[model samples]
Structure formats: C-alpha cells, structure tokens
Target: MNANKTLAIGCILGALAVMTGAFASHGLKAHLSSYALSIIHTGVQYQFWHALALVGLGSAMLRFPSRRLGRASLLMIIGTIFFSGSLYGLAITGMKWLGPVTPIGGVLLILGWFTAAWSFWRPDTDSVKA
Candidate 1:
C-alpha cells in the first residue's frame, strides 16, 4: 500500500489497540475467565506493539519510500488484524476454531519484523537511510 494509506491504517490500528486495552482492563475482566483475559492480554500486547511498528513503518516510508518497507508494513497490518482479531473473537465468543488462526498471525508478525530488518540490506535506492 501507499504511504498515506499505510499511515492512516497505522493510526487506526493504534487507536484500536488502546481501545481494546481499555476494554480488556475495565469491561472484559468482569465477564472473562482468567485464561480468556490472558488471551486478550497477549493479543493486546502484540497488537499495541505492532500498531506502533506500523506507524513507524509508515513514517519511515514517507522519508525513504521503500517497497520492502511497504511490504513489511503490510505484513504487520495483516498480523495485527488476524492475531488480535482472533483473540478478541475467541475470548468474547468462546469459539475454539479461531485458535488455529492466531499462530498464523504470529508467524506473519515474525515475518514482518524480519522483513523490516532485511529492508536495511535490500533497500530501495530512494530510501533515506540507505
């Protein structure tokens, strides 16, 4: 995706992370089991971090304009959506099928981080840092 779109998505994800965290802390705790809360906690943690990472990637892209960074940012978006999304669904609705999807998202998150690091090596000529 383009930098502007990515930046907007990052911002949205950041907002969602905060909102989800608040929900987990205030509202979800009462209704959820310890295990469910833990699941939400883990999801929120990863969600928050990746949201910031997405923002950073967007900012970096604004300066550098690297395709690799764009791809990395996209992966992070996918990861955040699936990873956090599944946790929220499973914990709230008690659906077991969603559990399998979480690991896929985790793998995507790992790949996103690796891609970001690799961007330094296979950087676009237009990249600011490169």
Candidate 2:
C-alpha cells in the first residue's frame, strides 16, 4: 500500500472503530446481550489497535519505503476487514458461519506483524538511506 493510502485507511478505520464502540455502548446495549456486546467490544479494540499500527506503518514507509511494509499494510487492512467485520456481523446477526473467518483474520494479523518486523530487521535494498 502507498503511504498516503495506508494513512488514509488507518484514519478511516480508527474513526469507524470509535463509532462502533459508541454505537455498541449506547445504541445496542439494550438490544444486544452482554455476550454480544463483549464480542463487538473485542472487535472494536483490535480494529483500533491495528488502525494505529497502520498509521505508524505509513509514517515509517515515508522514511524507509519498503515492499515488505506495503505487504504488511495490505495484510493488516484485509485482516481488519475479516476479523472486525465478521465479529460485528456475527454479533449483530448471530451468524455462526462468520466465526470461522475470525481465526483466518487473526492469522493474517499475525502475519502482518511478522512481516513488519522482517521489514525493519532486514530491509529491502531500496530501503532507508540511514
């Protein structure tokens, strides 16, 4: 992902995470069970954290520009969609099928972190000058 795109997406995700939290707490509290609310909260937390990570990745890319960082950004974006999206859908609709997708998203998130670590530890040839 390009630095600008990553940053934009991160900001959007962060905003959505906050909105989701507020919506769940205020709007859905009476409608949803405690367990459902817990699930939504978990998704909101993970999405918020990943969003911040993407913002950081975008800033780092502006300095160190690497293909690996781009890959990490893509993975994180997809992972957030899968993980948080599924949780929100599942909690709201009680969709059991989405449960399986949550783990796949978790795996993608883990991969994203590993890829980011690799980029910093063993950067590409076209990486930072200093």
Candidate 3:
C-alpha cells in the first residue's frame, strides 16, 4: 500500500487500540473473566505497538519510498487484524477456534519487523541510503 494509506490505517488502528483498552478496562471489567481481560489487554498492547510502527513506516516512506517498507506495513496491518482481531473475538465470544490464528499473526508480526529492518539495512533504488 502507499504511504498515505499506511498512515491512515495506523491512525485508525491506534484509535481502536485506545478504545479497546478503555472498553476492556471499564465496560468489560466486571463482565469478563481475568483471563479474557488479559487476552484483550495483550491484543491492545500488540496492536498499539504495531500501529505506532506503521505510523513510523509511513513517515519514513514519505521521506524515502521503499517497496520493502510497504510490504512491512501490509504485513503489520494484516497481522494486527489476525492477532488482535482473533483475541477480541475469542475473548468476547468465547470462540476456541480463534486461538489457533494468533500464532500465525505473531509470525507475521515478527516477519514484518525483520523485513522493515532489512529494508533499512539495504536500501533499494527507490529508497534513500541509510
């Protein structure tokens, strides 16, 4: 995706992270089990961090456009959807099947970070020298 889109997604996800965190603590506190709350909290943490990462990636892309960074942003967005989305679904709906998807998301998140680093380590023709 483009830098502008990445920035938009990052901002939206960041907002969602904050809202989710607040909802979990206030609205769901008494309604959810501690384990469920913990799951949501974990999701919020990962989502928040990745959201920030995407923002950084977007900002960097504005300065130095790179396909690798775009790929990293995509991975992060999809991974957050899978990881945090599954956690939210599992916690709220008690769906056990969602548990298996979390690891895939985690792997994607790891790959995104590594890819981002690699993108910086070896700048492409489109990217500025690091």
Candidate 4:
C-alpha cells in the first residue's frame, strides 16, 4: 500500500467504524439481540483501532519509508476487513459460517504487528530523521 492510499483507506475505515458503532448503540439496540449488538461493538472497536494504525503507518512512512511498513498496513487492512467484517456479517445475519474467518483475521492482525516491528528495525534511512 502506498502511503497516501493507506492513509485514505484508514480515514475511510475510521469514519465507517464510528458510523457502525453509533448505529449499533442507538439504532440497532432495539432491533438486535444483546449478543449480536455486543459482537458488532467488538468489531467496531477493532476496526477503529486498526484504522488508526493504518493512519499511523502511513504517516510514519513520510519519515521512515519501507516496503515492510506498507506490508504492515496491508495486513492491518486485510485483518480489519476479515476480523471486523466477519463479525459485522455474523451479527447482522446470524450466520455461523463467518465465525471461522475471525481467527484468520486475528492471525493476520498478529502478523501485521510483527511486520511493524520489523519496519522499525529497518526503516529506509534516507527517509528517516537524523
């Protein structure tokens, strides 16, 4: 993911996360079961966090550009889609099939963090601050 693209995606995801959270709390409260609402809430939280992480990754690239950082951002985006997306689907549709995807997303998220750590250890020095 290019830095600009990562930032753009992250911003959009963040906005959507807020939208979904509000809907879950107010609009969906009466319509959805408590269990379902809670699941969506969790999804919103993770989505928001990862969205911010993408934003951060993009910003950091301005000073410490690296392909690894891009990879990290990509993984976070994928993780957000699968992890939060699956929960949203399951909660909204009561579909058990999406449950299995959650762990895969979780794994992707973990890999993202590891890739981020690698980014720090080996940033593009030309881009880094002295």
Candidate 5:
C-alpha cells in the first residue's frame, strides 16, 4: 500500500478509537458492567497503540518503501481488526465464540512486528545514498 494511504487509514483508525472510547465511557457506562467496560477499554487501548504504530510504519515507508514494511503494515491492520474487533464484540455481546479469534490476531501482530524488524535489519540494495 502507498505510504499516504497507510497514513490516512492510520489517522482514521485513531479518530475512530477516540470516538469509540468516548462512547464506551459515556454512553455505554450505564449499560455495561464494570467488567465489560474494562474489556472495552482494553480493546480501545490496543487499537490506539496499533493505530499509532501504523503512523510510524507509514513514515518508514515514505523514507524507505520496503515490501516487508508494506506487508507488516497490512498485518498490523489485520491484527487490529481481529484482536480489537473481537474484544469489542465480546464486550458488547458477550459471545464466547470470539475468544479464539483474539489469539489469531495477537499472532498476526507479533508477526507484523517481527517482519518490521527484519525489514530494518536487511538493507535495501536498490536504495540510493544521499
């Protein structure tokens, strides 16, 4: 994905996370139990961090458009969807089936970070020196 596109998505996700957090705190406070609220909070926390990571990934891509970085960014997005998304679903609906999905997302996130590290470790032969 293009760096600009990745950055845009990251910004959007950050905005959504803030809105969701507000909604959870104000609107859902009365409806959900403390436990549920905590769960939702965890989801929001992970989402926010990952969103910020996306921004960093975008910046890295702008400086160095490595294929590994692109793949890592994609994996991060997927991780956010599955990890945070599953937590949100479970918190709101209390469904047990979504439990399994969280681990998958976590794995994706770990892999994404690993890929990013590998990308940095291996220098690009095509890059021109300033």
Candidate 6:
C-alpha cells in the first residue's frame, strides 16, 4: 500500500482506539466488573501502542517504501485486530475461547517488530550515500 493509504488507515485506527478506550472508561466502567475492566484496559493499552506503531510504519513507508516495512505494518494491523479485538470481545462477552487467539496475535506483533527492524537495518537503495 501507498504511504498515504497507510497513514489514513493508521489515523482511523488511532481514532477508533481512543474512542474505544473512552467508552470503556466512561461507559463501561460501572457496568463491567473489576476483572473485565482490567481486560478492557489491557486491550486499550495494546491498541494504543499499536496505533503509534502504525503511524511510525506509515512514516517509514513514506521515507523508504520497503516491502519488509509494508509487511510489518500489515502484521501490526492484524495483530492489533486479533489481540486487542479478541480481548475486547472476551471482556465484554465473557467468551473463554477468544483467549487462545490473543497469543497468536502477540506472536504476529513480535514478527512485525522483527520485520520493521530488518527494514531499518537494510541500506536505503533510493538514497545517495556520501
């Protein structure tokens, strides 16, 4: 995907994450028990961090446009959905099965970071070295 598209998606995800956090804090605080609230908090925390990662990925794409970076960003996006989304669903709906999916998402996040690191370590072929 292009830098502009990546940036746009990042912005949307960031906005939604903030909205979800706010809802969890203000709307669901009283309704949810302490354990559920903690789960929701975990989801919000991961989503917020990944949202920032998305912005960084978008910036990297604009500057470098490496395939590795693109893959990393996509992985981050998927991880955010699976990790945070599942936690949010499980917290609100109390479905135990969704817990297993969270680890897979966490693994994707680790892979995404590794891919991003590899992208940064490679020389920028588009740039003229002095």
Tell me, by lDDT, which candidate is best: 2
Cα lDDT of model 2 by residue, 28-121, tens digit? 9999999999999999999999999999999999888988898999999999999999999999999899999999999999999999999999
Per-model TM against the reference: 0.90, 0.96, 0.94, 0.93, 0.94, 0.91
Task: Measure candidate 2: CA RMSD.
Answer: 1.8
Residue-by-residue lDDT tens digits, candidate 1, 23-88 = 888997889999998888888888888888888888878877887888888898998899999999
Worst 10 residues of 2 by lDDT: 121-130
Worst 10-residue stretch by lDDT in candidate 3?
Answer: 121-130
Model 6: number of backbone collisions: 0
lDDT of 3 by residue, 20-125 (tens): 9999999999999999999999999999999999999999888888989999999999999999999999999999999999999999999999989998998765
Please say which candidate is ahead in lDDT: 3 or 6: 3
RMSD of 4: 2.6
Better model by lDDT: candidate 1 vs candidate 5: 5
Using lDDT as the measure, what is the rank order of every candidate, best first? 2, 3, 4, 5, 1, 6
The whole-model C-alpha lDDT of candidate 2 against the native structure comes to: 0.95
RMSD in order of candidates: 2.5, 1.8, 2.2, 2.6, 2.2, 3.1
| TM-score, predicted candidate 4 vs. hidden true structure | 0.93
Off by over 4 Å in 2: 126-130
Clashing residue pairs for model 1: none
lDDT of candidate 5 vs native?
0.88
**Model 6: how large is the Cα RMSD against the reference?**
3.1
Off by over 4 Å in 5: 125-130
In order, the Cα lDDT scores of the candidates are 0.86, 0.95, 0.94, 0.90, 0.88, 0.85
What is candidate 4's lDDT per residue for 1-130, written digit by digit as tens? 7788999999999999999999899998999999999999999999999999999998987667778888899999999999999999999999899999999999999999899988897665424332
Q: Which candidate is the best by TM-score?
A: 2
